[model samples]
Target: MTINQAIRILDPDTSAEALGEIEYYGGLRGKEKVLVACDEACRIAVEIMRQHLKE
Candidate 1:
């Protein structure tokens, strides 16, 4: 899937810091997964920011 597509799929699985290792230690090999995580994180962060701003 494209990065954007992965984002849609990934936006829900924000679990443990283990995901970080998948992104960092893996390096270039991990880029695709990292992008997936980042997209999800971005969507989540934006939702959180909006919630806080609304409050």
Candidate 2:
């Protein structure tokens, strides 16, 4: 499934761990961490949406 759409990257579940380095650095846990990461990743997606809306 999709996680970060700006990069059009899917959530690869083949990793050894679900939690990544960034979530650890952000001091987030579980669903909170996922939410935070999704929010952060959406910045560019939001910008692109805005650009399309203006066009």
Candidate 3:
């Protein structure tokens, strides 16, 4: 995902760890936080996809 779209990229290996980071960043947790996380995730997805597309 483009850096413009989000802060850090999340991975399966660090999903749990990232969850905690997100909670602290968003200042909340649970489903609500997941909803808010969409924007960030979308940014990451776009960045990764775009980079792959570049090659």
Candidate 4:
């Protein structure tokens, strides 16, 4: 899948500016890209949960 598709799948709320800032992973294949996206998404989710728990 393309970066745009991956971002939509991983975080639909992501802004256009954020999308522009994201570095291209030219070396990664489809599977690697998906894995990386999932990993980053999970990390972001965990951070959000932690912030909520603190409040």
Candidate 5:
């Protein structure tokens, strides 16, 4: 996919929202918080990629 298409697929705002919710509910701190956020973001990006690839 083109860069624009990838950006649209990734949807940073949505990813931010997901991470915000995780942080709010998870109540994690410091390095643990960073790790969870990164993991969640990666999972979301991978899922989006997988869906687009299927189409």
Candidate 6:
């Protein structure tokens, strides 16, 4: 699925989790951690793609 769709799916899962550390973390925090996680993942993926292109 697309990133947006993946976010939609993850949003609930994050929210439904027991509040402890991540839930109240609060801008790319709390249940929104997925947003940042996705960003990092995308960045890594892009970097890997660029490396392959250089080779």
* Leading candidate by TM-score: 4
Per-residue CA lDDT of candidate 2, range 1-55, in tens?
Answer: 2434424322455222434544555573655765665565566667778999999
Determine which window of 10 residues in candidate 1 has minimal summed lDDT.
1-10
True-vs-predicted CA distance for residue 19, candidate 2, Å: 7.2
Please rank every candidate by TM-score, starting with the best.
4, 5, 1, 6, 3, 2
Q: Which stretches of candidate 6 lie over 4 Å from their true place?
A: 1-28
> What's the CA RMSD of model 3 in angstroms?
4.1
Q: What is the TM-score of each candidate against the true structure?
A: 0.49, 0.38, 0.44, 0.51, 0.49, 0.46
| Highest lDDT model number | 3
- lDDT for model 6, please: 0.52
lDDT of 1 by residue, 1-55 (tens): 3444434444456433545666677788776876666667677767767999999
Task: Name the candidate, 2 or 5, with the larger lDDT value.
Answer: 5
- Residue 22 of model 3: what lDDT? 61
Which lDDT tens digits does candidate 6 get at residues 1-55? Answer: 3544334434656534423333456534655765555565566656667999999
Ranking by lDDT: 3, 1, 5, 4, 6, 2
* Shift in Å, residue 25, candidate 2: 8.5
Error of 1 at 55 (Å): 1.0
Residue pairs in candidate 6 whose N, alpha carbon or C atoms collide under 3 angstroms: none
What's the true lDDT of residue 19 in model 3? 60
TM-score of 2: 0.38
lDDT on C-alpha atoms for all candidate structures: 0.62, 0.52, 0.63, 0.56, 0.57, 0.52
How many steric overlaps does candidate 4 have? 0
> Can you list the residue pairs that collide in candidate 2?
none
Per-residue accuracy of model 5 over 1-55 as CA lDDT, tens digit each: 3343334334775646544554676674644664655655567668878999999
Candidate 4: residue 37 lDDT (0-100): 61
lDDT of 1 at 9: 42
